[model samples]
Target: MPWEGISGLVNLMGTWMTEDDPPVALHDEKAYVATPDRRLVFDSTSQKTLETIRPEGGQPVSTLKRGDRNNAAPPVVTDGSSPLLLAPFVVRQAGTGTQASRTVAELVAADAKTGKVSWRLRLDVADWTKEVTDSLAISDVGASANVAVVTLVKKGSETFSNPSTTYAVDLTTRRVLWTQETFKASVVAGGVVAGTKRKAASDEYSTPTGYDLTTGAERWHDAAEYFNTYLRPAGPDLFYLDARDRAGGKNRLRLVDVRTGQTRQDGVALASRCRYDGVGAVVCWGRDEVTGIDAQTGAPLWRLPDEKAGRVAPRVSSVWHGRVYGKTSNDCIRPRPGVTSWRTGIPSEIDLDQPWSLECRRQGKGRALAAAAGSASPGRR
Candidate 1:
């Protein structure tokens, strides 16, 4: 198809029939260019299938492969990663030249004109027809566009121990820099840091661990009662993670530096997520109201006072910037009107230099509790 519709309404689209290769991604206003047959790219605009593209006379790229080895979950895009990553599959054939089952991961990257194969790292399958369980993860290091951390997990047979491994792959070299056991991981601050939960005791408090991207070493470990690694675009110091210590009913906001691993009181007690409106300026969303604060000292900046404060939750909440934006509960999926704003406050309103001023009131409550924005994140393996 050719360019049609409005002046600025041009879109490129394609699909591949083969399997086990990277896909292609078209630059803006480019032609129906194909990637090398050995490559494929995931078109988020088009569904989840990997579409194949061949650059005129280049090799054929396979798209839309399966990863049904041992009933593991299918590959889904992580927060930040180039091209795209897919889980391996075990293909089973029923007839001539027809694939019935397979296990492979498809990585797709873009190039100058026609996208080329950065690499096609196949899943290490032991048998041809035996069942397999595998999982894959990809993380984009915000600093460099050419490097990505890829991880894969494979389960052993019923009689063998569980088998899994994580590989930090270089997209430019198509080489594995390091490999280790699969650790439950989360990407924070645009993939600058990998947040993993490390609980030393079942009955004791939980802690958060931050690993360096370059060396894969633990840079900082939070052992406090309510400390966790969170990623928000506040500064160049990896991210500003919120931590709070709960005594009776009060939870204070403790801002932690991802680089130095030091904690400071930001005084902006948010029930959920908050963002910096400006330098050292914080806009916190609460269950009932939204408050701005000083980004550096964590002092109240301003309060977008709630009109009907009694109906909303006491905790802070947020709505990320995307195609749409609205307030929702910290854990709720649906956005409601009464939900508090996560990033509505500014640092110029409050006096971190002084103390937060608020007129307290209480009424018949149902689920109102004090929870800060920097609460600990559970589920770290």
Candidate 2:
């Protein structure tokens, strides 16, 4: 199918056959079904069952046989390293308030064909007081070719506050690469990891830090990427940085490329959120107007309201390949869909640097994009 649509009058027609299978972790043409005790592997298109793994029931291991409790929760996250699947079974060992509790992430590398365990590497994620039983669970993850990041946050909550820990593990080196406090891993690609961090002291513009994916060295930490409005990577090297000019009372969107070490500023006037269309555009969608930013360049390439000031586009949520998919406030009453071509640049809007400024081109209700943009990306083994 083509990427763009010149008009906004499309709607989904019908559905297809569905399954009761739990969400599959897709890697290449193989789909892995992982649970706490059992696993299944099958072909994606052919629907051929490849393997099934059942529990090896036995006595508790020697370590857990003692008084300590061992709970290897379900494998909520899984990745593929070719013939082996990097499935993390987060094991929590409860401890007395005085002895301290322990959490171990035993990444089992199971062969895809035989469903046999090829290797295993266990990492001591964190130790906490008995009172903090579930706060240090692995909530998010990001993995590249060799390095994998596991993010720890409160068990039931989504946002990480106070002190969140994200650890990078080197599968080849068989060790934890580095650990960051008050940091959450977002994207790991192009030999770099990008994520937002809570400032150690102050607020306002939060921390944007980067590190070499292989070397684990501090790479980029710019003040322009705000913690509240974190910019998702348009490409491996392309992401927006909101640079505020205090004296001028305007904010310049600085487009920073980690690969070429280049920085270009544009007044794209994007607020709230942005996501890679998984294609060539970084779409900023929310509220009334939805704008598209060219990933290669920092310029806004398109806007909802055309030169004739058309009604605002749907509160765009998903952009895959190039087409925009979302719902408008009128969905309850009347909704329409549309698309457009490329190369046409989006208009720039300069937001006030200071707070307490309100300008509504149109008063329309909308839902912000998902808070965790590019949170836990599985990597190639």
Candidate 3:
């Protein structure tokens, strides 16, 4: 499902892209380097690494007591005067008994130059994860410049752990704004969280609810009792929820605006995965074909298998800036890697001679496409 091999940098000028040699060729994991001064640092797990960039009197910060352990999550880089570095650190007093350890945690703020804690706030770890871990820690973090959402997960199987408690923090004031009761969050964008809620106590909650990411207020709910339980975000305020009839007939999709709920409902069955090109089109790939729909009107834009199937339809790698870049599905023949316009469903004239890798900006922009790579390729969001 992922592209493996070398990475090549190409610049798109319209219908053509000129290839260029990149300055560095690190593997996906080691593709980034942080710089405080003129020197380059790898940001290893060390207190010294934080003192690269900073501000004058970095503000009075709170500290974990002499024996308290701060289980910190990864830091999220954002723009603002809050702090050069912000991370959710779960601080706990040492103990080894039932239900593990401490529920105390802190969302920390600091400057890169001094690594001094600009501020810290106690976090509320959900009761769901109490029995799962002997200690509390932030598993992952998602944030904008002003708001941050941290996921506290439950012990899961080999595949992955599910989120139990999600906390939204105000980055500016270093305050815990609100908490969402989401067992699993699908997507968070434009201050909206769309995910499955814990209606009662069981983990079998299928109804996906859209909540205000900033305030954790319930905005809308989608019934996903049977067929499917996924919602693809079309915009900050708009998302597409499956509203198909369980009885039979043609499946339908409801385009919902979190502000007022349902906007436009269409009788179109989108693929299992869909990408909303920030523009006005939503490109989707069903099992055997690719389709496009106008995000606003919910009208069908185009679909593959209409004559030039092999040349246009790709395996659906990724959609960015309104273009879908992917390798052709019919690889048995000559593999044609192309970029198709999600709005038109027509393949671009540009040909990616090196189809070895795909580019995804997960951590930061420094994460380039790994060329001539290995087992782990660059991640996609």
Candidate 4:
């Protein structure tokens, strides 16, 4: 598809898609464009220029890319009355050979409604010396409340190792809250979880630590015997998955309350993969059953079938409003069931399982319900 559209009436080149990058469309019917020389936003419908930002001599690169695995911290649009846009800019080093140049990563924030730049911060990788060239790349960017969390990974031609660091910035005042050296990090409900491991140390243990989001104070830390660990944030709690227990029998899932640093549920067996439904429940699937767990409290609210059976159970694909949408195997011919309310513990039958599609729509201004499609997934829910 063409990336630029030339509107002869306005003499402007509006952007739809760029080379190897995704379309940057905002809430107010505007699209963002970043060329090698300039960055601009234009109206999609009218093809009129709204704002333009031209860097002096650096290349203007778009942070919005489709299927970008390199950037762990991608651009994010925060939720509020006036949304904010956080983006990254990369300035290519001007040189040749291994020690000729270094790359710089810049983080910029702007008001989404108006294309005004709020604040710009330059992330320094290391001291640039004549001997060695140093470079840095943004790995991740996550936000919660009024704070923006960023992770920068070091990349260069030198043989020395450079550890990544995570920084928490206050969006209101544009001041940095705190920064810590860690390998990986994520923003949780009330804090940030950072994973740290030593380089080339045989006996070094990897520790996942939690820090306060507002003040960046150390709240809690969990040291693991093994290095392979995963942390997932769901609501007000953090789920720690320890793979060391897999050797014993089953994997362990630890649910820790982010506020008090207390382990609410420890050493729980994980049957299968689980994910938050964005409503108020964590939907998980096991061998032949699907279960819903309350987010606030780590209690299982409702289980399908209500009894153990060999029948293939439906797996939750998406949840919207108050209904859960899932699909079953083709061999199972039983009608699909729906849970009326997780709080009320009621069950009802909706329709039979389709081959591969699921959809949901509102009925006469009522709640949304799941409906089957022939070959596509749910449209809304």
Candidate 5:
């Protein structure tokens, strides 16, 4: 099939005849397509093959490698000059019984243009027992300044026991800068924001920690204990929601200064689910309301109250330019008072003016919001 007129297939594995496969668009008019054994870059306009990229050392490493179920799409980062691909390779040991397999996770960087391997770093595995099966998967990849942040989840056989680790790699020198261990982690502002959970007999809460992306040194740690919290990249700051009460009881929406580890403002109480709209605001939905907050300062910008009766609730799906696009639930709009719209469904958009209210709504039928033209959507990748 022709993918956006940017890529098409030539053949599939084990076939001499020409076939078609989906293509990955890189930049400009160039796209990458997979063959039986290698990946080829071709021009979309001219329909001419530009380059054939085979794995170095005959080891399979292409994101389009066939039959490799664990392969993930390599994240591409740029140093403001050229794109660099962060390729992940999984080496599984052959064993049985208590001798569980050992997985070697590697992070390799290659030049996007020449497809030449530049640097490789072996990611460390979490300490595991022989009886436990362990595996590692790349969860996130991001870059800021001269550092590239890669997050991996080291999972064992036990449920909910997996801990994610974040590694900061210096792109200029191609060296491992630092690493941090947390339940989850992401690149935020100029540093790394990591979260860890602690469970006690009386209380269970999570903490958000900040680290310097360059040196991998601990910058600041929050002393507050939250029932649950989610961290998101908000430009140079971190936007987070902390739930103190369960089941739509109460939530705090705040923006953290990644450098100072402080809230940009006294965060206001809002719903648990929220999305950053790339254009300097975040939209959150509750039982009967939708809200917009400034991404940088955490100040309330607008509020839309929905007094409609039923179990259906309004949800902000995506924000583009200055518009908040979302949908409304068809079930019970007001299933219960104080309930959130996190899981509710529907499609709608809200005007950003004061006393915000629904500007657009599609009842009964729903359509997913499209990405804003000429701008990237907010939140995290």
Candidate 6:
């Protein structure tokens, strides 16, 4: 899709194709279809309130005519039931944008029927010196909800060079509940566990810390440097992989507990990624190997014989419906003898139930060659 701005008729016509409608395209969850009576709404971190657009009689609406700015990605419309919250702000260096650019956070809420903005909230968080990565956290606690966590970044403006802070905001109030300055920590993968459901976040800071859902208060914390990549949490033990910095590179693998702040895991280099498979299965991939670790005690369950699993070095993306999805890069957990290439291909989702079989399959003619070559073939070839 075009990154930003409007596309003319020619471009629109050329780009138009029969694809599934985006699940979110409406202000209200009940208004799913594109109807003249209903309005379309957009909410962003920059635009804190929601914006609405509606039809003017039989013609197009004025707001609809306006191009989508602020949001680099097309504003994904959703049935209001579940809104696809987007990145809040463009984390540019401070002093770059004019005073007008000083505006830090913006939010819009729109009228469901007329597509007019019901409310708009904008604020200035001052000039940021360091480049801010787009990472927003939204959550609901009790009766109130929060929209932006930008304040947390602003609070630690002096430490902008580090750019590692765990921020939690109550969307209902558009207020920051807590901002924890982490050393190298972040909100864990999967997302911050508030009540029951999972929430999308900007960064996965390592330190496991809690903040008051209402008032910004530190409730609990865990050192991130002590662990590798923060995997999802288990009961009392949090599952994660740790990387061992070596001469030229590092090796990563999984660890259990280690909350005492010690940085050691039985000499197992931190896996590139580690995730909970089901109740017991903890899937982990290191240099040239993917193994299922015991979720309860962090023991090695079964190692996938694929020697390239480490080479694939897929970041454990997600564990859903019994499958593990990951994206691999050149910073492989284990690099092969002569391969230094980086690729982000869809690796097979390892299925925990079928522990004996490779869950992901190769595609096209490559699959045949892979089957014929067995484990001897190089993946990059």
TM-score list, all predictions: 0.43, 0.60, 0.59, 0.61, 0.60, 0.42
Stretches of candidate 3 above 4 Å error?
1-93, 96-100, 103-122, 134-145, 155-163, 189-191, 223-228, 242-254, 267-269, 295-298, 307-312, 329-338, 350-381
- The alpha-carbon deviation from the true structure for residue 355 of candidate 2, after best TM-score superposition, in angstroms, is 44
Query: What is candidate 2's lDDT per residue for 194-268, written digit by digit as tens?
Result: 666666513344456777777767787754434333445555466665544434545555566754435744556
Question: CA lDDT, every prediction?
Answer: 0.34, 0.48, 0.47, 0.48, 0.48, 0.32
Better of 1 and 6 by lDDT: 1
Question: Which 10-residue window of candidate 4 scores lowest in summed lDDT?
Answer: 372-381
Model 6 Cα shift for residue 299 (angstroms): 4.2
Per-residue C-alpha lDDT of model 3 across residues 235-331, encoded as one tens digit per residue: 4455666533444633556566645556565545456556666567776675666777776666678887577444345555455556665444232
Q: Where does candidate 1 have its weakest 10-residue lDDT segment?
A: 372-381
Taking the candidates one at a time, how many backbone clashes does each contain?
48, 9, 11, 5, 16, 52
Could you give me the TM-score of model 5 versus the true structure?
0.60
What overall lDDT, based on C-alpha atoms, would model 3 receive against the true structure? 0.47
Worst 10 residues of 2 by lDDT: 1-10
Off by over 4 Å in 2: 1-25, 30-85, 94-101, 109-118, 127-131, 137-141, 155-160, 198-205, 223-231, 240-255, 259-271, 307-311, 327-381
> How much is the lDDT of residue 62 in candidate 4?
36
The TM-score ranking, best first, is 4, 2, 5, 3, 1, 6
Model 6, span 100-189: residue lDDT tens: 222244333343443444444443332232334243211111122323333223222121223333344444565555554432232221
> Taking the tens digit of each residue's C-alpha lDDT, what string does model 4 give over 1-381?
113321121112221121111223344565554332334566668777776654322443333233332212223566688776665555554665665555555667777667787777765443332222234455334577888777665553111234456777778887777776644454455555444433332222345566777777777765444344545454445453444432354445666665565666664424344555456766555566556667777777767655554333465444433545544433211224444344433435444334222121111122212322111111100
